[model samples]
Target: MKSLRTLRQAAAIVPIAMGRGKGRSRQALAERLGPLRGASTKVAQLLSARDGEDAGRALEPLPLARLLPVMRAAAPTLLGDGATIGAQGRRASLGQVHRAELSDGRDAAVKVLLPGVESDLRSDLGLMGWVGRRAGRRLRQRFDGVAVDDWIAALGDELLAELDYRAEAEAQGRYGRAVSSLPHAVVPAVIVAGDEVLISTWEGGSALADAVAWEPDKRAQLGEALTGAILHPMLTDGLVHGDLHPGNVAFREDRGGEIVLYDFGATREISLPARQAWRALLRGEVPAWDALLTLGFDAERLAPLRDRLDALAALLFAPFRERNATQIDGAERRARADALLGEHRMVPRLAAPTSAIPMIRTLSGLFTILGHLAAPMELWRVFDGADAPAPALPTRAPGKHVAPALPARLLVRSFGEDGRGVEIRLPFETLPDLEDLLPDSAREPIERSGVDLGALAREAFARGPIPQTLFDDVVEGRRVELRVIEA
Candidate 1:
């Protein structure tokens, strides 16, 4: 249900902040946002994994018309004197992309941040950290691993970088230079940049949405191109376009399919060892227990989830495996992942390898894109042809699965601590503000069915010491530092 406070807040901004364009009215899109919940942290970090994207897998652009005033105010800063806004424009995540007629006559897309968005972002991240850290602290009493506060702070920083336009321009420039070999992808050219504004040559071609209607081969080509663009940069150059959802990529048919990436604000850089680990994993070499530790696992806490390691490895890399999946293809994969995770049975753990977070985040986003594109193909083939030597990864024997306890024992020795040696009846509290997590869609169904949906949601998410199995899926996610605390 829309809160009275929220509805009033919407009334104040919708007219002032939304603008209609040639296509969708910006106000309509805002309404679609469903009760302007405290600034849409749903922006999901471009570099970020939503507040719970890693934990539970979790918006729209503001209008361009009403936004022109702010755009004009920042215009001279980005496009120079006499440069004014053009009528036709659209929205990008967290900002509006306006058509700008520069003083020099170059047409560009000018991006401007809405005032106060930064505060809202901080608030959302704070809430997430408060909740996640509490859960993390409990896990730590029994499990050793990534400090939830640190991971939250790192992610918060990554998301915060998107608010700075200048940082984006730098990332854009570097990415454009790095992808010279990815013939199918187009990285935007930075025209002029400012702390709050970014001006770039506008890109055109059908969006990935439009291409969904195209032939499967065309879609497959697009999927392949995008995967290569993302992988090449991260694996070879250590830079990655952290956001690659269908909305962020555009497709044009000059040859098979040319993919264009927009919104560089959320770029993430990967470390070399992390890249090598990914290469090794792809060849079926699950990293040694130590490698997993470096990648972000808390050994003592992670011991119980040993079998799920294969599931975690597969989840981190898929969206391509399984007969080359497309948007429509993840159910089988998700089911497989769910089975491996056994989220309901396993104690919750969040053991993310510190260095590999970006790659994990990218994969999370990539899996979502493949689900949207719904195009299937053999993803392993994409890497096999590369010069990166294919090390013969140790594969598991037919049906027998076993835990690497020796390595776990060794890891504990190396670290010299056994997590929490004593149990003091660690207390847990209910999830703060369970009301905040409710989905708008639930209300209508409740009204129609006379069901107590709010009660149901609260029942499931009511906070306290989070169940060890409560967020096991997130624990398995490479982006989150996780561990299993056997009760």
Candidate 2:
């Protein structure tokens, strides 16, 4: 039975089993749960799907034939008794998408979650979350200065949200309003929806990635459209389309070929100040230090490293500086990336303002679309509003002292004999007391010398309020296998 307790139990066991060397236990449990509705079957389905492998070999996709029955039973109950199925098609993801047309001739796309998918996803995410935390901890150990949990949790949230069409409808509305000013862009309008079923106006366009074979000028136009539709929104408005991989975007040559954007599930928005700081930083200026400080940096940590932060900022933004539009070959970009990573290991904390995590994902996702098109556009030029030409890298040495970017959530997950011993969650706003972030079990070891918690926070955080260093030590300082999760 699908009870709250069952879901919670799955959530509890999965990560704990993963944290310990209980891979066998996790795998066995996943297997045992296979017969249950929406059980662990989806774990391998998503994995293989993303990897571009034979995903059906891992988990069978519901063929168009089988989709109708599931849709038939669920649609009337979900949409209404008057709803009728008009059209059906296979969505790119592992489910059938049906067009529900009413007697009134209104049409919409309805996606019903495959049987047992929600439960399967929960288990998969729990185990996958453990792996992500482990990876984050390992990366931290190497001083790579990245938090894996932040991205992973964001990812989990996005995937789960996709199951709810109502959320997607709201996001589509938000995106439509956000980019309403862009010339010749189309965002589908959502008509109505239940938890799993969405009814919206159908959208049609050529896949943006499919346009790679188009003429250079046409592809370039599409690239610019992609930028206006996807990139500029983040910089100017902070609202963003998080999943911009090739398939999610398209172009239409029919009506003057407007860039068509869809799949509004994985959406994110950055703060205004963070966006402003990014613009300043990309323009080869000192990123708005005040904005950076507002993000939560202590003056003490920032004072010693401002110049280096700028230097590192220069290196990170180097790739975007080349605005030739067509001059960059893949090899050269790779070389520059390698050189920067080799000569100076730029800290991740210094790369962007902390609140820009969504922006960070959006920017990286843009390049991924570019790589698919092999149509790398002059993104940097957009910032300068220039036409003559731009340099390959910053004309000056880089400098910027970035305090460790504060996490959205601070999680101290216990890795005791229970594996799921206990956790302390400190949202950024409530982190007034560093001691409060730890379990009673952790305070004794942390306050060993009666070190002033606030002073240590000021020294380590030098930004706003998190002493992630102290938190990191609490998780890592122990020789045991404790895991620290950055919220």
Overall lDDT per candidate, in order of appearance: 0.54, 0.51
**Per-residue alpha-carbon lDDT of candidate 1 for residues 1-487, written as tens digits (9 for 90 to 100):** 3345445544443443333242433333334442233334343223232111221012344656566666656665455577767655554445667777788877788877765667665555554544455445545565443344335545655666788888889999989887877778888798878777788887767755567688887777777887787777766777878755555667886666798888888787766655665666654455544345544445545666666776666564654344543333556666766677674333323555333456666776776665566766566655654436534333222211222332221111122122211111111232233234323332243335455534533543443232221211111112211121212
lDDT of 2 by residue, 159-178 (tens): 66667767777888889887
Off by over 4 Å in 1: 1-84, 130-148, 286-291, 311-328, 344-349, 384-387, 390-487
Candidate 2's C-alpha runs over 4 A off are 1-88, 91-96, 99-102, 133-140, 144-146, 149-151, 287-326, 343-355, 375-487
Q: Per-candidate RMSD vs. true structure?
A: 14.4, 12.0
Worst 10 residues of 2 by lDDT: 387-396
TM-score of each: 0.64, 0.60
In angstroms, the error of model 2 at 203 is: 1.1
